[model samples]
Target chain A: MAGTDDRDVRLVAYADGELDEDAARAVEAELATSAEARRLLGIHRETASLLKAAFPESRYAGGSLPPAPAGRARPGPHLLARPWAGAVAASLLLGCIGYGAGSLWPAPIAAGPSRMLAEIAEYHALYSRETRHLVEADASEAEHIRAWLGPKVGRAIAIPDLSAAGLTFAGARLVALEGQPVAALMYTRPDGLPVAFCILSAPAAGRGMLQAEREGVGVASWGDGTHRYVVVGEAPPERLRHWVGLVQRQI
Target chain B: MADESFRQALTRLLPRLRRFGMTLTGSGTDADELVQTTCERVLGRAGQLRDDTRLDAWLYAVMRNLWTSELRRRRIRRHEGIEAAEAVAGEDGAARTEDRMTLAAVRRAMDSLPEEQRAVLMLVCVDGLSYRDVSAIMDIPIGTVMSRLSRARQDLHARLAGEADGKVTPLRPARRG
Candidate 1:
């Protein structure tokens, strides 16, 4: 153990880049003299790199983020009020006619769809295990749930039949996503794990299916420009995707 | 800080927190939960955050405390132990490709490490925290941080290279020289 500690102490300094000049020089001398020291240092470097590779930061891009309550209003759009000013200036400078400045510069991109899924996953993790206050509309009352949510959500709300996927409709609720009302449908497997479908009225941007895992909850979201749908569950990705496929065809 | 700025700042730090959490929990799901809980706690107690400049370290410490509490709760409950197979990447075919096999093996090896060592290694190696920073975040002596980090790397090497036989002896206690 003493020998192991000595080897580790030298290698840790080298691996962590924390050695002072004298300590570093001494360690370098030892490395040149001893193959075992050199091998250990090599292993330390490899392990650090491998750990970073194994768990890259990007994997947690939208991980388990709570739904932000609401953002404050942006500073007024005085610039947007004068739309033709930029276009007129550009056309005069470039000596071109009909120079549409709106098309000249691209619009800023909104939050990515992955964020929506992460928010949904956060809710899923928070509420899946609850016995009460789970939903505003219980799936046991399927007729009432559909009738209540359909018109309010600004779309025809149908609880997709997932019996083929070994899940049953548990209930439905209305929740806010990004300050907009969204329809949330809950399903449960035989083992009682709750699954949720969060539907939002979003602009038609065909951001195909986006899937992610947050805190053990799996989320898959897709949109057809008019409405976006997210399915949150504890099931495997393929299973969630399979359920989403069926829902997509029906809804 | 303003609520909006605080939220935005906290949002930007999510990836790092999640990565640190992934090391602590050794499960993506638990790590995400840890991140979520940390965010919630931070948002709930925004007024108490005296040093906005040290927000990152403060968040790390909050997450560490929450995880420690969770570990204690799980110990008292004696919950089912984590499965070794769950240490692999999530259940996505795209994520489970042959190219990720090395990562999977490394993750499995990391999962075998003691939670303390894994936490220290990630803070020092991945987050690039100094031993002093790690000591502050982990609330341990600097010497202990170094030894734990060193042991963590050694254990990782042994397990990855197939030199270890499952059991690792504890290092000597930390003391000022």
Candidate 2:
């Protein structure tokens, strides 16, 4: 067997049809005399042939073709049948709704943080109850929590002070939202009630303040220039709102 | 005048167009999307199709552009685990299971190559575009395309050969030539 070297690599390249006529011919001449070269060439050809044989047969499963901007319906059926058409349509529709609604909504100062709160509350509900795996890291390791989550989230996040709010900080945990890492701070009031504050880096393009009501949890979210925060709890809207305000001052 | 004619021609080529889109995208959903986007763009710029003879390449160029842009967008959004090709490869049933596996392996190997090499190999080997045509499509010098193709093929050969040893069963003596 010929030792695999730069020359053998080059021969492999030649077999791929990468070389020009002169280069290919030179390699071919070498192959004529070298059994190892011949073996290598055979392997290359067989691999290429196998790949070609595996190339999929194209089938146009028909449905609707895309419409022209002029709204002229093309000769085909409606584009809705095509899966990508639906995705593109959904994206366009969402973009339009977002654009239109964005104009109507006022840029509330508290809205971004409130939404983050809601996300935190939800995260709390899902994982806070777990005794063995309640959080990614325990609250005692506040420094490590910040270090681990800060760079991933692309923003500096300080866990908020909740002792004054009548809750002990149970520590912060890392979570994922829309592929971006988020920071969640869990706290338990004196009565054993758990509350959470979730913070995510604000999208670069910015987003309008979004308020959500899920189950019995009230979430208020607002974003500043650098970060978006959400506060979630079982407390009434006004109470959650107040805690968020305090958190805003501390963080 | 050309716009209407282009639309007419595209309607006829839709099936092959879809197939090419599927092959390139590796996902039926994304392939359909790429084809639709290509159609929309083609329809919008009907006047651009001055040469009817090169319509196939033109459509391919449009599809390729859209796929590249979509990939960039996904990368920027940090949206992971959204592989369109893997999704499509999983959809084919047991009848063509072996073929699908082979193609999937090839696709993985192709993806493992650098972007430049992958593009060159796809254009020349799969798309059956000539070296000259690939040069035109990629907007690179012919020599560059050749070099990339060589590098791509060498890498793919190594990967596929390695895969064959573990995955492929040896042919019986009677079948061996």
Candidate 3:
């Protein structure tokens, strides 16, 4: 069935820029020869854009959101707890690289592996100290988290229990880096020290842990062919490696 | 992570998520409810996120899951797809009369699509998600995503073209028992 009418499928792929260099060249070659192909390609592209314009975000923007749920603390203590103390403590314990909003996210980041890593490392630094609403799903809900996050992340989200490492499951949230969604599962020690494990949906070619620390925060990342996993926020690289090992052995 | 503010970021995403809800459930009320439920779910599951950003995609995933379960629970609930069309066809969107009418016609044509195809079309065409993104969100294969997207664009184009040419008359049947 597909072989009969997949010409448009290929055209759509080409239009969406999903086609590889060779496939794209072949399509362009055909487009050069066939006006019909050119027209179809144009129509496909137009229709796709028109379909988008039809559902403008402004059209759906006005509806009110439901009330905030219970148990979601309203950023209370973190506000009153001597802001400087929390700030100083966070740096002392974890020493996350990028401290401020978007200003001081360490220089060596651009020199990091990928933009996803740099951006996610920044996210870890920014939110690592968040005391309230720490996770979208609490540690208690770990059992079915894989079921909830697997399909969204394109694979099973391995929620590793780091209790033996004195790191409780702080929470997990689905965040995006550079427009692609990543699952950020956070863990914290009793002293409120944070460790984040961010998982990207895409697979990797090679396998090994790439460990680094920008200025303060530590990030150790690896891939298992299925998905790329990055362990951020742990210190000294050795402990980071240990946690990564625990995650690898478990998952 | 795209936007700096959390609440503002989520509020920014509501309309888009609501529009997607309209696509899934095909009714304004249901769309709102689904989006609201999604917000509530995200709040209840608040640990699911923090500052990494891309809340829009995550919210869409959460909303899609909520709607899918609601779809299962409701079991064959009738859909008009008009509410979605109307939601988009309102006066503010289209600048000129011809544009508005064309938009309305285009929306109706979209409304006429199979729910799955409409969804694929919306995500690809309207939301600008890649085929792989749509596949992960919809939990379908890339091949399935491509075929559905292809068929949907073809159907929509054909319907609109037929209308413009007056080759096919609009069909509205008498009420059935």
TM-score, one value per model: 0.54, 0.47, 0.53
Candidate 1: Cα lDDT at A60: 49
- Candidate 3 lDDT by residue in tens digits, B13-54: 776776787677654434544565566566545445765535
Residues A1-251, model 1: lDDT tens digits? 88779767867877788888888898898889999888888888878887777656665455334655344321221211122211111111111111111221111111112233345555667777775867777778888987878776678887888888887877888776545577888877777578888776644222334445434566665545356567778866677678877787677
Q: Sort all candidates by lDDT, best to worst.
A: 3, 1, 2
DockQ (0 to 1) for model 2: 0.17
Question: Which pairs clash in the backbone of model 1?
Answer: A139-A171, A203-A225, A204-A225, A205-A225, A215-B29, A216-B29
Model 2 chain A poorest ten-residue lDDT run = A91-100
- Model 3 stretches astray by more than 4 angstroms: A1-4, A72-251, B1-5, B44-46, B50-53, B83-89, B167-177
Sorted into a CAPRI-style docking class, model 1 comes out as incorrect
Candidate 3 per-residue C-alpha lDDT over A148-249 given as tens digits, one digit per residue, 9 for 90 to 100: 677777877778888888898877887755355667888988764688887765331112234456565676554443455767774776677688778877
Candidate 2 lDDT over B59-127, as tens digits, reads: 777677666666555532111111223432233565487777776667556545554565566556655
* Residue-by-residue lDDT tens digits, candidate 1, B140-171: 98878877888778767877666245454232
Error of 3 at A72 (Å): 8.3
DockQ for each model:
0.17, 0.17, 0.14
Q: TM-score of candidate 1 restricted to chain B?
A: 0.73
lDDT of model 1, residue A174: 79
Instruction: Write down the lDDT of every candidate, Cα atoms only.
Output: 0.60, 0.55, 0.62
